[model samples]
Target: MHDLIPFIPGSVNDVLGSLPFFLPEIYLTALFILVLITNLLFGRNSEKLCRIIACAGILLVIQRDYQQIQLLFMSGRLNGQFLFNEMLLLNRTAINFKFIIDALAFVLLLYFGWDNRLKSHPKGLSDLYTIVIGSVLGLHLMAMAVNLLSIYLAIEMVSIASYLMVTYRSENAFGTEAGLKYVLFGAASSAMMLYGISLLYGFTGSLNLFSGNLLPGLIQANPVAVSFSLVLVLVGIGFKLSFVPIHFWVPDVYEGASTPVTAWLSTLPKIAGFALLINFLRPFVYFEKWDGFDFKLALSIIGIITMIAGNFAAIMQRNVKRMLAYSSIGHTGFALMAIVTYNSTGIAALTFYLAVYGLANIGALALATYFANALDADDMNSYKGLGLKYPAASVCFVIVLVSLTGLPISAGFTGKVLVFSSVYGIYQQNHNLWLLLLMITGALTTVVSLFYYIKIPLNLFLKRTEFVKNTLIKSQNIIVLSIIISVLIVLLGVWPDFLFKLF
Candidate 1:
């Protein structure tokens, strides 16, 4: 019986260790099921209940995970490796730093719950909450997934949820059109990615990323084939991230989808997509094992093109959501610079940047939703004179815009500086003139971005336009969350080390 007692405790510890790492997902799963039941049982009034339950579930996970962070760090619990046979491994770096369900997700959840734009839908709110929980769960998994199969499943899960969200208002033509575009593009990309994965698996006979033994034979066999497979895989990731050349669907989709859903779509998928990029590139960083490939060079070229294209395209946009969509593409390019570094500092910087970026984006979208509701407009011209009518929300908008432009005393600036410094460190070590040029171009684009990002404030505050009075139904909860996020952005910009230590 004494020996049995020891075995019982050991089994319990093993189960607890595996379970705690997945707390957020477990909460989400329960919320999804409960919301579905509430929708079926309570009918019309279930929307509010569903929303509250979803928000509560996410909050509970955040609170529990945060309390564990100190312990995780102290015991170096943040640095474990759990392998599910030969296919998947969950590591501390992937969970704590990469799979982070932190302030960013919390802020996004707040935005999702507070945005009244979603209330415009005729269907029960339960459906929206289910999709949100499921999609976010997929995003969290995507960030931690280290195998090709897991990656595909994660992306598809998010993609399907996104399609439903886009077409939620199926009575409208725009919604149907956006859904079709998304489904077609998403399906094609997934097929290509699957084919690429098959090729990779055939060449290497393994899918586990951290094992680091799958690529040598492929690299020696045919460089062109390997590069082709890499490009195919990136195509799927780019579809999710909406990077240049593959970004054709973004503007239309953003304009068509409900604002809150668009906001969620823009932030979460990009973060996970970048995480997957970092995971995919980890083995190739040293180049000692694979001497023939130039993965860094490929990434640098893609980053340059994505940034330039996104910024230039955004400059011509009239719709605010469309412009933000393009701006997201440009930000993806900026984040890629850190990925090019292929080191811990680079990964840490990327993680920090995404968190700040997600918060800023959610705040900006919240303000946009308010403006759309108040003025019934989404064009840049409609923002004229908003500063006078909706002063608080307008001010928040300006601050978010400044942060997006990478201006001083904002989280955006901190993110930019971190990526810049990390890339410079890499450049200094290698003396790579090409990277230096790309960095220079990125800086120049930052200035160019300022012109467009500030156009909202300029339109709102400085321009003289007709006073169009409209109902500005302010949600106190959303406003407070925005203010909090804005303050954090400025605080992190000033004292970045405090934020860096979290990673």
Candidate 2:
């Protein structure tokens, strides 16, 4: 082999440049390798040790990255493009908000490890943590990727990891079926996205999304083809976000996967997917100025359809996971409203909304998982009399459900208000009557959403069913932590500025 000294200078500069921004992922990678090796060498007893290391690694990343984010913003590196030939961008906006994302991942990771449901299967626990860390690292990369190739790779990385997490318990038919469905659908979507990427590259002669200036010309030349390519790409994103017309696999996967994995699947990837959506749409924000391209109208139509379809379908669901899956689809539409505004305030609102929404969803899923394990049922009917049997847990569930419904004095309400006001501002400036119609539709959907959301409390508190032994098993630390998150949800709703200030 050639002497290493010849490449030392260039390699050193690359390493140094990528070091600070990649610290969190690097830490995770190291911990993941350690966990794998320890499991192989030290046997099953070392599973808990791996969990501790994973949790510590994630927390350390969050703390270090949070400080790094502040420093980067203070130093005016918010928009700085670092190593890898500018494929990776370290922006203040992404950096500040991604710290919160990392923290959210830490909370979910802690819950995944500490939940008693997974404690008996040590090897599975280790494998699950490894997959989670891998997916989280992919998400971190996705938020910063500036090229089409990096974007596709980041998405596929997360997708493959998620498929494994869904199929971890492969002995069961549900796990096997969910895994098969996910891989088949995911592979097809990825292939379509790749073809779209190839078309864009062939038309533009560049793969760097930020620097590529061919979209306007291509759209003018062939509006239909460009729109086709855009839709094809959105198929991949829509799968992750679980939007209408591309959400057929979500309920199956959610119902089949274990509750903890389902919780992670529902929240973290969706947040990252939305962030990617906002980033991709930045160039198309001035669609009116571009010849023959009406991206805003297209997005508005999709948002409207997603909202109506998601809300109407959710009304018929009795399975808790299935209902939440539909509810997530509706929230996807709500989040897309912020994207339609296409301004700094809209981005900020979407970021804050996603943070709170993810926290609440994860907390709710944790409680749901606990109840499912305790009662040995995942149906809504099993929740009957839970209000009296498990008052604290049931109350926490109510708070989370209320937040999901966007009721007053909850983060969900603040998120909805922010999205509505931003869209309203856009409407006032442009006199777009369609926005007002959508706003009204969104309001009506929220009311409809409340009916389904309240079903949990109704069954638990109001309707009495066959009485079972009301044994009070001490709450897991994870459950208590989830409740604390619910408290933050309400606090952020009451004082919306608390999070906005960080960005």
Candidate 3:
């Protein structure tokens, strides 16, 4: 019994040793608590205070993330350490993911209050800040999590935060309906994931993916059962990634939610989802002898199908948000191409691609807000002839769409090139059919994407409307942010190495 119990003092020492690596998460938790308390004490009066605190806290967290990178450099490149009794793994990849999440989150925190609809909520934006802080913490956890229990908890934390954000304006019936649908889909997926986790634990007698017992125990189990369990777990993650089949909730939710919340949904959670997926797949991909399932083949087919479905469906939509919603799903499929390679080059490309995609996606949506506020336009038809009146905003919108469409001299183009290069490199070595198919599908989808993306620019610059709105409502904040993002997209495109070196 004593041998089986092991030593308690050693575990305590291990936890104490892990604290330094966990400083970012600690600070995030502290920020979450501070924001919550501010919201409670001041209520509606705390909006500006909450935003200030949230943005400053994110900066602090980003600084800590940078420090973690320096520590990784000092320790030696690519080496990682498990923390909190092997519950989490800290590495260069995880740190990079956290940095991206925080960077985007900072933008989102500022944008939330800028939107007139969200700003006018009766309960105020203070609580929204608090919820975003909590979600950021979950995103950080998702990047580092190596334990099944930790993964599930991190995902649920983000999910619940998202549910609240989508329906922040409870006065809007559409928003309430979207929230209910999101909750329902999320609940079902989470339950499936929990059951899957339990099944995996039952088979392996452990919840840690990195533990010695997990792989060997899994290898000996019934292959059919193991595969079923893995698929169930993927369902939960798929919900966040919004891949086909599980992606049904995205169009409705994104359409109903405020523009800022739509930006948050399309970027932050999806970035974190990729990180989680990478962690989930690492063990199975790297294990020498385990061959119970073919992740490569499964992901490849899903990628091809997802890209086709998302892009084609996007063509039929005239509503700007719904179109972007489907476009995001298409982008999700394209990102999966990198994951299938499972190489260092592929991972680097993925990080860069996601960063660029997230920026452009956010910018595109911000422009939607700009048009909405200034012209009261929400669909493509209403955009006709407005380009001449709003030259700056219109040009910025064009640049963003170019980036999203992966056109030349934009970050999106560079990202696609890198993904193509990485996949081709893998194909050169193994000559795998799936790799070839992914590349082909990726290229075709890029072409298909052009049809819908071009619609906005055509309507803005080419199509003529008999009547144009001269009266405008000011939304300078959103317009400014969109212009900045457009510039970054162009800058990063010309100098891809700026991000490449970092990744």
- Indicate the TM-score of model 3: 0.98
Question: What TM-score, to 2 decimals, does candidate 1 have?
Answer: 0.91
Candidate 2 TM-score, true structure as reference: 0.93
lDDT of 1 by residue, 187-256 (tens): 9999999998888887888776666546776776677888788788889988988877788888888878
Tens digit of lDDT per residue, candidate 3, span 1-503?
68845777789999998998999999999999999999999888999999999999999999999999887677664579889998999988898899999999998898888877778888889999999999999999999999999999999999999998888875478878888999999999999999999999999999989876888998999999999999999999999999988999999999999989999999999999999999999999989998898888889988988999999999999999999999999999999999999999999999999999999999999889888888778899999988888888899999989999999999999999999999999999999998999999999989999999999999999999898886567798888898899999999999999988888
* Candidate 2: tens digits of C-alpha lDDT, residues 1-503: 47878888887888787776677678868877877786677677666777787788888878777776766767677656554755667666667556766788778877776555555553657767777778888887777776778878989999999988888765368767987998899999999988988877777677776665655556545677777777888888878888878888888888788778888889888988877776667656644455554656766777888888888888889999889888988888888888878887778888888888888898888888777657755778888887887888888899999889999899999988888988888889987876876788789999999988989999999988877545434447756886798889889988889887775
Q: How does each model score on lDDT?
A: 0.78, 0.79, 0.92
Per-prediction TM-score: 0.91, 0.93, 0.98
Considering every candidate listed, which one attains the maximal TM-score?
3
Number of the top candidate by lDDT?
A: 3
1 or 3, which is superior by TM-score? 3
Candidate 1 ranges beyond 4 A from true positions: 1-20, 67-78, 97-102, 113-117
lDDT of 3 at 71: 77
RMSD of each: 4.3, 3.1, 1.4
